[model samples]
Structure formats: structure tokens, C-alpha cells
Target: MDTRHFTFALRHHMVADTLLLEFHGELDAWADLELAPRVAALLRRRRRAVLVDLRSVTFLDAGGLRLLLRISERSPRRKGRVRLVLDSPQILRVLRITGVDGVFTVLGELPVPFAADDTPDDTDVPA
Candidate 1:
């Protein structure tokens, strides 16, 4: 058996009280197995919105997408939301092709301080 480990560095940007988490590493199988849970835990903060920056990510696979979907689905229950800051065409295509592009809100880049007028609907997300 081959043991593979992924090294990840996480940074956060505050936008309108929301948190945008930037990932630095390959969000692949290894990441899903070892890093996803940690990332999710880190994101479980007191906020209404969060964004995962996948721009610096070198590789992404099904597991990676699944992790995002899981986070997006779970975030709302906590009165919060999760979005993606993906700039790569390949990454965008993957999300769109998977038909999950609608599942997560994507921004042009990582928006800081969720615009003054940019208020999200209070569906499950808290005000």
C-alpha cells in the first residue's frame, strides 16, 4: 500500500463578515481523505457565508467536488453558506459539467466584505 499525504495551507479573507477560505494545495483524493474534514472544521466558525478559493489548487477530482458539495449543503443548516472562488477554466468546467455549478455561488474572485448592497437572502442563512 502506498501512503500519500497532502500538505495544505489555509488562509481566510473576511468579506462583509463572511469568511473566504483560500486553499493552497492539490484538492485531490489525498486531500478529500485527509484535509476535507479539517477544512470543514476550520470553516465552522460564526459567520453566515464562506467561500473556498480553489484558484491556487493544482489538481481537483471527483472527491474534491464532492467535498465542496457537502460543505455547501451543510453550511445552510448552520445559518451559513459556502461559495467557490475558482478562476481556472478547467475547474469551472468541472463544476458546471457536474451540474453543481448552481449548488454553490461562485464569484469573479474572492469578494471581500460582501458588498454593501450585496446582501444574501435569509433562506437558511442568518442575517
Candidate 2:
């Protein structure tokens, strides 16, 4: 319900069929609820792949992490893949400590280079 201090920008690379969702500002408890539905709707669009560019995100709590996990789960069932572009040590530590790091493929940084025929490797993604 509250949309203050939060913004989301989406940019797609048609060549690689990757949807880069850049999240800026805060992703706290309140924003988590509102943000998830939007993300879910976008995922349902059959974008082929989703790359969440969280590098610009200033903060992400447990709720935000949950949202990512949920979306990751849905992407595969819908015949797509999800990758999280995150470089923050805080987020990395949290994901690692909680054992969710293996749940999602965490890219080292943003602007991930992809070839036109890039395809998800079965070994690297979740079932």
C-alpha cells in the first residue's frame, strides 16, 4: 500500500532474452508485500529469463529474500530461469549463512554479459 522511497526499473535485452529488473531504494518489510505481486506478474509474462539486478539496492531484508526465492521457484516451473545480480557483502553473507545461496544463482556483479544464444545449464539451476 505504501509506495514511498521505493522504485523499480525494468530493462530487457532482447538479444539474450533476459529481463533485467533493477531495484533501487529500500526493500523493507512493507515494500516486500507490494513488490512480490508485481514481480510475479512480470514472471508470468514468459520473458524466458529474469536477472534481478540488485546491485543498486541499498537494503534488502528477510522478506525481500523470500520474495526472490518464491520467484526463483516459479521461474523454473514456468520454463524459465532466474538469476540474482548482487555484489553487496551483507546480502551475500545473509544468503550464505542461511543456506539459500545455493537456491538461486548469485551473479558477482551487474551488467552481466550474455551471448545471443545463451541458455540455462541444467546443472546450475534448480529443479
Candidate number with greatest lDDT: 1
Cα-based lDDT at residue 101, candidate 1: 86
Off by over 4 Å in 2: 1-15, 77-81, 111-127
lDDT of 1 by residue, 1-127 (tens): 3333335445555666566566666666666666666656655665676677788777778977777776776563454346788788988888888897887777667564543433333211101
Q: Candidate 1, 84: how far from true, in Å?
A: 1.2
The pairs that clash in candidate 1 are 15-113, 15-114, 16-113, 16-114
Top-TM-score candidate index: 2
TM-scores of all predicted structures? 0.71, 0.71
Q: Over the stretch 13-119, how does candidate 2's per-residue lDDT look in tens digits?
A: 33356655666655656556766766676667777777776776677778777877877876734433577888899878878888888877788865536433334
lDDT of each: 0.64, 0.63
